[model samples]
Target: MPHPSCARRWAMPKKAKQADLKKLAICVGLGAAIWAIPAPAGVGLPAWRLLGIFLGTIAGIITQPLPLGAVAMMGLGAAQLTGILTFQAAFSAFANEIPWLIAIAFWLSGGFIRSGLGARIAYSIVSVFGKTTLGLTYSLTLAEALLAPAIPSVAARAGGLFLPLAKALCLACGSDPANGTEGKMGSYLMMTCFLSTTISSAMFITAMAANPLAVNLAAETLGYTISWGTWALSALAPGLVCLLLTPALMYVLYPPQVKDTPDAPAKAKEELKRLGPMSRDEKITAFALGLTVCLWIGGQSLGINAVAAALAGLSILLVTNVVTWEQCLSDNQAWDTLTWFAALIAMAAYLNKYGFISWFSDKVVGMVGGLGLSWQAAFGVVTALYFYSHYFFASGAAHIGAMYTAFVSVSIACGTPGIVAALALGQLSNVMGCLTTYGIGSAPPYYGTGYVPQAKWYQFGFIFSVIYLVVWVGVGSAWWKVLGLY
Candidate 1:
């Protein structure tokens, strides 16, 4: 009481400790609650499986090891146990061409990373652009855009390469990678880097693993073939424009922090220099990745299969001693992702086989009709379904399985552009999944990062979701209409 300053100082540490404890308590409580749920959708698709998703998501948000892939497996097991899904129906994601493609893509990406080619490319970009935060913005966005068309794994695209280097750049720019990023220019930088991967990847047919699946779902289910090249050019134009402008957006979204170091950018450059010359692994990675791109563009006209192209590249990597099978096996995300996608895809096929998704959509259409909305209202309802309907899926491929048929039927009823509607729905699967980091697409790696706080990361995600829903949709609608995709 006699020393006012001492008392004020003394109270701060206790408050800080209490806040940390509170956060821990909240994470634990959420995990427990999710872990304890009853079965969902039925006994096999138990409530606990859904809860496992919740728990896994929570674990990602908190950087905990809650076993997300396990959660997905449990979901499949529930489907089997409860007879909601047959073994073939539940396990087919593993066998599908699409899931295999994604798995293969991850393996290739892993080889590149382990080969040190990824870091070499990253370092090359940084050497050219790491001098300032603004410079870094361009480099980060550009690198991702360039890579988007080739590598389908957004996790590998963003988390493996994008996040690490981007964080290092920010750290070098004197921006703290800690809790204070929100109010600083660094926050905007981080946000933009994260979302840009999603945006740019939206452009190419193979920009994302989901894109091919989405495109195929439309062709097979709706009888239209929107070729790989079309999406690449159409979506890419706007995507590049959006990416180029992200630096400016970040500048406006969060002004430079007063306390941030001015010499941060230079520091990062120096650290990069210390890495010295590129190693053999790095050299192989670059040549292989570059060759992969060349093959992708060239193979399209040469009648080469995309999967075959990937296999060939992977073969080269293994043959050249650029990568080992152990590296491939140790790639937890790659393996786990294949399994995860396979399970969800299997579940999706199951729903289609069982008439569950179509049945549910019929109910929705009937209920939506009862609201007495105008054609525009119907449009909005259908559109909302296109975006928000990802709730029932554990992967983007799964979403298509569950809703592609209904989406096509709705378009037919509304006299909308069938191909456009299909593409829109497919795009929405990605966009909606972006809403929550734990959504079907990017949930795994996102949840596994222990550095960022869950609330904060989610805060970024919510903002990001709104941007995609509002800005991207608005822009994409116009773009699709222009291309007659709408």
Candidate 2:
């Protein structure tokens, strides 16, 4: 017989594997069953079939049946084999500029991590503004805002850059996530960083991958062109308000025991000294990052595409050896995100191509029309429903692709102004992401840091969602009136 310890260890993995297989089987079986059920006479086979696959995939993601990329691919493959989607259509998402932009941004972030440039910036800020716990939180918020305009992947920004620094800072302060000492300062910092990045992601068109995707959908659905400046201008007031208020609010709501951090600035300085001067790799990463930011900001005037600009920046990272080819290829998160995002983009595009979105929008318009409410009142109800629905989504891009067009169409049919409805829904795409940890790319990593418990995360998410809705929608509507958007 095997030794008892070895037997227990081996059995544990086997049991877990069995559980995973069972979940996968359940997901696949449910999808097939759904597909087998005939749709109502008016609904097209393609639309109904696609819905089945999409639901199954989402369930699989939530249920942990398989890796997200694997589940996404399985959905695509099922659609192709069932004749719901053509082979060419299934592969088209890989060609999408938005997903590739995200991938390139991920690669660039690797350069920042490997070269220590991201850490250097974080420490520098903390040293300057670490006199109090609230000051440190503000520094993190400021850092995230400064970097938001240039970095399209909030995962890379929050997960890759800010997370490491936040962890290090927590450790330096003698607060550990794993040892139940998180309430000292780690939880507060983690929550502050998470919320700050979420708000910052709305401040610029290029701040997060989902922003560009939202812009594309708006242009396609409404024939409204939203420039980078236009997106930034619209979000400036509301985004800054949320960003400024978040840290202070967290300070009041979840005050850390370690309110005094006077030694933190000195500690940061000492830590910087220990690391000595910046290296060649750091310099290269810094130069590439700066050049890329300038290019992205001015790309419209230069007639350069954002995706192409990111690719160019990636090439610079490669040539300078700030990040090795092996490192880039080995980044599982980047590749995994690319696969799932591409597959989702393809599926969403086909939904629009096949008239599903139009049908859905028509139904919604009918429902709202029957209510006899005025346009503003109707829009308020529609916006509330749309914003809260984010709790079901794991990706902001997916939410925007699925619901944004339909909601905007309904709002317009209800007599709301086109520009007002378009921009409101567009900005809320990022704002709703605050509703849950899985609501956006950056949320998962921040949650995975182990500082905040899941229940508290959810509780706090609800609290803050109400706060942001008031600020962004209430205050934002008034600001839009001033800008003559209505």
Candidate 3:
């Protein structure tokens, strides 16, 4: 007989396959249900058919019936096979600059981890402000904000850098979930770190994997161009307010039992000492990141495309041997993001091109118009509905794919400014990830630490969701008005 462990491993795949098939059936059922409906007047048959395939693709993304890339590939193949899109059109997004920008940025982000610059920065912050529990949390928040632009994946930053550091800080303070002492400091630290990641993700277009997707969708759906600088500048004020307030709010609401953490700064100092001086690779990575950020900020004025800047930075890293070609190939997340992102962009672009989005937008506008509210009031209602709808979504990318365009359309149709609608919806797309533990890529690992209970997690998630909405809408809107975005 085969070893029991080997037998169990083999059985796991079969069970997973069964579960995947069930989810696949649900996705297919949803597509078929929509596909069977008659195409609306003024919407072509092909556009209607593509909507079904797109919705099914989004379903597959949310339900994870297969790897995201595989599901997207299948969706593209379906679109082509059904004659909704030609072979050339189905694969066209692979050539688009947005997908390549994100993928190249991902590779560039790897330098932070490989060179240990990310950890060094985190440690240096902790060494300064870690004497108090609240201070430690702020240090982590600051570190995260600093790293956000360079690190595209919130999960990688939170899980790989902050989570480990938070756990270490917990142990140093005599707090551990394993010992029923998490409430002392671990719970507060974990919750703050997790919540702050969402804010940092919103602060930059390159901060999260799905952010560029929002940028692409906004441009394609609304004809509102959002450059890297524009996104960063618009978010600067509101994002900073949220970041500064998150630690204090959590401190007040979920106060740590151990307020004075004298050991933390010392621990951080020891960590810094062990890390020693910055290596040559770290210096090179920092220079490359600095050059890239400067370019991203002013490259447009200088006639340098954002994608070109990213490619240039990546090229510098490659030439210096900071990260190898083999390492780039081995980065499954980067490649997978490129694949699904390209597919979704193609589908969404065609949805606009084929006029399905416009038809759907008309229906939504008619419904909202019947309420007879001012456009501001109408936008508020739509924004709230859109923000809270994340309860039904597990992936930000899936949520963006399914709802972002339609909501932006309705907002603009109701007389909301096009840039205002696109940017508001774009920022909320990242902030809304706070609603559930599975809401985004970064939530699970922090929650899985067993520091915060499920009930409290949801409770805090809801509370922060409201807080985020208020800050983004009130403060963000005022700032945008001053900048003449409207």
Who wins the lDDT comparison?
3
Residue-level lDDT tens digits of model 1 in 249-273: 6566544553334454464456556
The C-alpha TM-scores of every prediction are: 0.67, 0.76, 0.65
The weakest ten consecutive residues by lDDT in model 1 span 1-10
Better of 1 and 2 by lDDT: 2
Could you give candidate 3's per-residue lDDT for residues 1-486 as a string of tens digits? 111121121122221233489889999888888899999898998888888998898788767788767888999999988889998899987886656665675566566555666556655666788778888888778988898887666665565456655655565456766568889998998998899999999999988878899899999976767999999999999999999999999999999998886777788778778878788888998888778767765675788766777777778889999878877786665676678767876887787678776675566667786787888899998888878867645467767877788898888878899898988899889999898765766676576566998668888999999999999999999999999998
* Candidate 3 C-alpha error for residue 68, in Å: 1.3
Instruction: Give the C-alpha miss distance for residue 358 in model 1, angstroms.
Output: 1.1
For 75-182, candidate 2 gives per-residue lDDT tens digits of 899998899999899878798665565666667765765566655665677688777888888877898899888766676567645775676566556666545778
Let me know the TM-score candidate 1 reaches against the reference structure.
0.67
Please state the error at residue 385 of candidate 2 in Å: 3.9
